[model samples]
Target: MLEKPVNEAPLADVTPPRLEIRNLHRSFEGRAVVDDVSLRVMPGQVTCLLGPSGCGKSTTLRMIAGVEMQDSGQIFVDGKLICDTVFRVPPERREIGLMFQDFALFPHLSVADNVAYGLKGSKADKRARVEELLVRVDLLRFIDGYPHQLSGGEQQRVALARALAPKPRIMLMDEPFSGLDNRLRDGIRDETLAILKEEDTAVLLVTHEPDEAMRMADEIALMRDGKIVQQGAPYNVYTRPIDRASVAFFSDANMLTATVEGALAMTPFGRFLAPGVPDGTAVDIVFRPQHLRIDFDRAGQGPVPTPVDGTPARAVVERARFMGNESLVEFRLDHDGSIMKATVPAVFLPAKGKAMWLTIRRDRCFVFPSEGGA
Candidate 1:
């Protein structure tokens, strides 16, 4: 079990990263599964690899754990080489811990025995370690119980205890909270994060859920097509995405097409700056659903232009659904009959076929040159 330091020394700002990988690549069946992946995790920091399933996140984690070898690249810990093309280190000797969705506790072993499986020491030391980890995970009462005797949440805690018993320098977790019920997952994730921080272990977490990444990560590496498309803090990555796909990944996006003229793109929402783009270039004005504001129609007249919300565009309500704290309303654009969505806080249900004016917050919108355009 990992113990809190009695006299903890402050980490120097100049300390090197705990885990680093450079230009990692892996392939199977003639297709590249993990392509030129590279990332770093600082001591006590959690970096989440977030992307769609089959995007090679798990494969990348496996490569780091040395369960699978990379075709190329180098793995290092605190400036010391662990693996490269010519040199290699075994996974068991690397001092890294792993936790996965399936807790995979031994059904036959007692909770204390399972946690002590990877520990090496005298019997008393092992027992002490097991007891300490079980206590940290709030499962000390289950120490003598078999895996089958505990609930799913309790079993997961046992698995966590087992992983931390060895006091590894780095921890790799692949959707560790996925198996828990939704109501239970958040609390467990918080507890696990707290434990990892207390142990001062570097963490590389893999998850396809953006919310999970946002909540748990110190930094997020947004992966797609076997490559990291963007890496930054959650707020920066969400608000300053590099492309249309990156923006759409985190929320429902609404887009309007426009042609550039005089260094600006004219849309029903009004003109948006298209800086450095040549005239006649096609651009896509993208904004999130929550940024769209709904106003009642004054006969056929839409709302007046404002500095913040450029211009109100007319639309007919197609459908509306209550979503807890907000209502999602879909509208059919009057100008081109395109479907767009808007979110309104609280209960504001407008009838179907009712005309409403929708204005987008200019600061919340992004203008990107259309794909396949010059």
Candidate 2:
């Protein structure tokens, strides 16, 4: 008999998710805080829990860190059950590191001592680990200095070093970069991500800032009203949003209302295909500001229609502002007199009341069934 090929050999190298949560639920005063939240973060991956305030992002992190007990559901680390409704693991015993906005460094202890706080083993081992982590964060020279002697960014580095000293399987960071100055935030974020990736730790970071999430996350979990509405790669979540709210969350969105007929939604510019939506259903056609094209008017008439951009519509510029990288121009359409916004990649600030033709890229727009409409 011929030897059978073993499929398990190739899959053996495929590492399982380092952290996993299943159907996690928490409620406050009969109000659901985190409802049926489920997600997974693989080793060396940075997953950001992104949303506005009061979205239960912090609560989810707290639960994973074993600081807050989930009302229901299970938490797993490397496929091992750690916590659920009844079974639990103490925060200290969970092998999970936490870095919050506040550095929370020991005021009385030196940098070396702070980093070595969670470490164990012989004195020499602890000292070596402390020195190694301090070196990683480029704070080795300040090992003997106390927390107050350092700046906010330095303190954050120390906090990160301390958190990683124990080699936790999962790291929970709640807006750790929020306290740093704008100039320092980017640099520190890059450095921290590099260090965490090197350590192969699964990081679950919580932040309300979309830019931060887009910059740092390998995967983004977009939460709203205590539930995750969408989760995917940053580009996928941004480009292929599931709903109007998801689109508006990332950037300025231009929307127009229309009713579906023959699987198409008609607008002033053109028709948008709303496949799967029933006929006679009201829908919203949405597109980002960048997708709207501006053109010069020709004797009060706009440009002819094209396959990709559909039709050009006449509009009057209401306002224009050069926002460093791009220019934002708002207009009032002549057909409907409704406000619409567009962005130019360069400085092309037209004066207010200037007449301009507008066209939307048909391929870039999204059509969704209107909320509260059948």
Q: How well does model 2 score by local distance difference test?
A: 0.93
Candidate 1 C-alpha lDDT tens digits along 1-115: 9988989988786888899999999899989888999999999999999999999999999988989899999999887899988888999989999999999899989999999
Q: Rate residue 353 of model 1 by lDDT.
A: 99
Candidate 2 lDDT over 1-374, as tens digits, reads 98868764554576668999999999999999999999999999999999999999999999999888999999999998999988898889989999999889989999999999999999999999999998899999999999999999999999999999999989999999998999999999999999999999999999999999999999999999989999999999999999999999999999899998999888889778888888999998899999999999888888889989998888999999999999999999988999999999999989889998999988899888887596
Q: Which stretches of candidate 2 lie over 4 Å from their true place?
A: 1-14
lDDT of 2 at 111: 94
lDDT of each: 0.92, 0.93
Clashing pairs in 1: none
Per-model root-mean-square deviation over C-alphas: 6.1, 1.9
Q: Which predicted model would earn the best TM-score?
A: 2
